[model samples]
Target chain A: MSLISVGEIQAAAQRIRPYVLCTPLIPAPWGDRDRPLFLKPEGLQSVGAFKVRGAFNAIGRLDAATRARGVVAYSSGNHAQAVACAAARFGIVAHIVMPRETPQVKIEATRAHGAEVVLCEPGRREAVAAEVVERTGGVLIPPFDHPDVIAGQGTIGLEIAEDLPEVASVIVPVSGGGLASGIGTAIRALAPAATVFGAEPELAADTAASLAAGHRVDWSIEDRNRTIADGLRSQPSALTFAHLRQVLDGVITVSENEIRDAVREIALRANLVAEPSGAVALAAYRRGATPPGPTVVIVSGGNVELGMLAQILTG
Target chain B: MSLISVGEIQAAAQRIRPYVLCTPLIPAPWGDRDRPLFLKPEGLQSVGAFKVRGAFNAIGRLDAATRARGVVAYSSGNHAQAVACAAARFGIVAHIVMPRETPQVKIEATRAHGAEVVLCEPGRREAVAAEVVERTGGVLIPPFDHPDVIAGQGTIGLEIAEDLPEVASVIVPVSGGGLASGIGTAIRALAPAATVFGAEPELAADTAASLAAGHRVDWSIEDRNRTIADGLRSQPSALTFAHLRQVLDGVITVSENEIRDAVREIALRANLVAEPSGAVALAAYRRGATPPGPTVVIVSGGNVELGMLAQILTG
Candidate 1:
């Protein structure tokens, strides 16, 4: 399949304009680091994460008949909340099937967005979601595995190009490779001079493995995915892998300690509340994994647990 | 003492324009509040507080001859950091004498901004600051209560008017009347239809008492200042009192527990970090003390101790 193009990203941007924020990119002070760094603060987006872009884009692209059926998603993370938030804009009913083990804060936050949350046993969330679809005729909106979702995410690249103008490199946290591929597609088409790097915690380096193998690779769902960066452990889907291989310049791996440090630094310096997964790009930047252009790091989300934050910032 | 003139506030906006963020005032969507509350995100300012306005304004309005003499202040909190940061922008040397008990983070942050930090015993900070001035030929730049500082703070009022032309009321956290006077003057001049409200924590109600008494009234600096809202214990100065008398339409006070709740709500809903002092406006709003207006609350700062944030967010 052909990769998403600038025109598709442009169209996606237009569709999602009403639902998402043109989140500001703040320039890191010249003295704080060895090189210039700019943060694309997706943490400020609706539902407080970059997932809003793809969620809205996907929702907007849905046919009129399909939207009448409402939407369901299986996620206990930013994606679930993003879909819930975006669906509310269209007055669509959102049913989010989350794991019972999900934090009370996340569940409450998701429900707070007007979504009906169905908490299920961890191993059977998807089955529960499918059962709901069969019962209620709700359309399943998978996170980061569809052409439309990737196209929607590509719009962020368009914004980065417009804001930074001469950005030499862009770093994104890779969970399912959706964000990276989408942003990579836009950069390759609009800002041809810039390189895109995908960041993943070393403990959950499935994306890197998938890239090296030139196919979708799934590690044991529970094996080696034990990093505190909870948002970056998703296995890459075949559709996203195809696009990632076509657009991404490279992937960078970071350790758990590095992710923790980046989160703490952003909180202390930038006055941000970055979840561990949200800080992987900063982790990569701190570890010298960036390719030395006017750099932009995606601050992906800010749903960090207060308990986790205390442990990190007390140091 | 004369009230801060609208002309002075207008001029201060130009003077501190380069040093501070005209922080965004965006629509607020938290819980189920439908009355269109807007957040004046001063917490995003350079030093993570609106105090930068006064600092920058005070520093910028210095006579060229006086600026060459440098400046000094005694603060163990956000005001100290704001002055240090704003003063550094003009290449002026700022000597901040903070209480020795001040958090090391504040000490390092002030030093990082190129300000010379002098730590002294709590009761002796101001005394030490005066001694430094005698040695270094520096002028004392009080954290608030000076004409230039009030004028500088009024620039925030200018921004509030510009950002929310239709605002019905503006609520501000009161440490000193400097912020209130500046904002009240701007609101009275530009948004003539808008009411100005000064907010204070009940635990440190010196400002409220001063306004009632028609003069500066000192509370127990030791006992009255024990609230988690560390920024609102100061009594208004003659300069701010004059402006307060001319411009402020109302004043409200919230309990210390209410301040903590406000801080947590602002963070979870606005995707913004606001310290206890910054949260007093929201606290007032939640307590039904806000006037019948589309209210804009000035989120004053975001410099909470890591331990404190843990306590606030968790409980």
Candidate 2:
């Protein structure tokens, strides 16, 4: 895939202007050891994650006829909720399929946003989503693959460049590689001097393996499910893999412990709530990856369980 | 004291442009109820509170000669740190007198910014700060007084109006009344339709009393200061009182239970580590303040103890 250009990113910004927030690029806490940390607070985005951008962009582009039939998506939380929310905004129905173990908070929130949620066994989410889409004649919205979704996600990078063009490095935590790929594509073109690194939890290092091996790789969910960074569990999609190939400088992995510590560090030092996945990038930066100078860390999401939050903070 | 005008606030926004962040106004999570709750997020300001606006606005106006004598202040934490940090930016010597019980984290953070730290008994904070000013010929930087401080705080109201002019009600947590007075003044001027309610902890309801009695009321600092909302314990200053009398629509007291619950609500729903004082305004809104339609809560600060945060979240 050709890398996303600055012009494209600027266009994405314009397209997403009505639906997205120009999320602030805030300086990290003053007590940091190295150069300044500019946090791209994606947590402040609509639906409380960067996923909304992609969700809205995709849903917005659907033909009126298609929107009338609604859309279907499968994910544990962020993407599932984002598409559901975007559908509601456009007055379209959303069918979200999630695993049975999906958190009650996420399921209820997704349902409340006008999504008809279908729960399935861990291994059957995609099958369940496909069945629903087939039965209902609904279009399936892949969490990360579609071009509109990628463009929507790329808008986050546009905001970053507009907000802090002088950023030295853009560190983004990776899961299905959707966010990292989209942001990296934009940064490579808009802020050429800024290096982009994809961060992954050590427990869920499929993206790192793919980067190392130069091919798409799949790691079983159970194999990478040890980390509390729930959002980092997915292996990269083929589309994201292609984009990462062109734009990302490298992939870095942080331990589950590092991710947890970084989450606490964000709460204590930066005074922000960072979910485990969101903290991976900052964790890699703090542990001294591609460093020194103006670092931009994408704080990916803020959807955390109350029990987990207490656990993270108290411990 | 004359109320700070909307026009003046616009000017202050320009004046302090180089010094502080026009902190992001973050929207609460989608499940965050009928009236959308947008936070002014004073927590993200340069000094981690809205105090920086007042501190820098005051410090910015000092004559060159007076600036050389440096700035002196007294507080338990946030304002002391704010003054110290702001003074550092202008190359001014900051002499901060804090209570002996002031956390070492704050004391070190202030001193790390090159401010002189003087620790005194809790009751002697004001006297020690006065003595330091008198002996050193340093200008006393009142934590929440003077025209510039009010003007600085008034900038928040200006931003609020600009960000959400149609907002129907604003809930501001009041301490010494600097923030409430300035925000109220600006809100009334710029967004005349918005109702500005002062939120206070019932345990430290001095501002509520002062507003009712038409004078500053001294609330005992030693009287069961067990409420997690530590920052709202101060009595209202005369300058703040003068502004509050002219601007605030009403004052509401939140119980200790409500304050903790509010803090938790912000953490869970808003995904922000709002300090107890910061959560008070939201507490008022959530605990039934039927002022108007759309409500904007000024989440005042993010300085919080990790243990306290854990306790709040667990409950």
Q: Which number leads on TM-score?
A: 2
Q: Candidate 2 on B1-315: residue-level lDDT in tens? A: 555676666777778878888876776644246677777777776566778888888888889999999999998888888899889989989999998887666687688778999999878888998999999999888877777787888888888888888988888988888888788888898889888899988888888888888788777888525556878877777778888888888898889889888888777666678888888998888766546467888988888878878888887
Least accurate 10 contiguous residues by lDDT in model 2 chain B: B25-34
TM-score of each: 0.92, 0.96
Q: What is the TM-score of chain A alone in each candidate?
A: 0.96, 0.96
Docking class of 1: acceptable
Error of 1 at B208 (Å): 1.2
True contacts kept of 1: 0.28
Candidate 1 is scored at a TM of: 0.92
Off-target runs (Cα >4 Å) in candidate 1 are A30-32, A123-128, B5-11, B31-34, B63-66, B123-127
Using DockQ as the measure, which candidate wins? 2
C-alpha DockQ for predicted model 1? 0.41
Q: Candidate 2: where are CA atoms >4 Å away? A: A1-8, A29-34, B29-34, B224-226
Candidate 1 local Cα displacement, residue B247, angstroms? 3.0
Q: Candidate 1: lDDT over CA atoms? A: 0.81
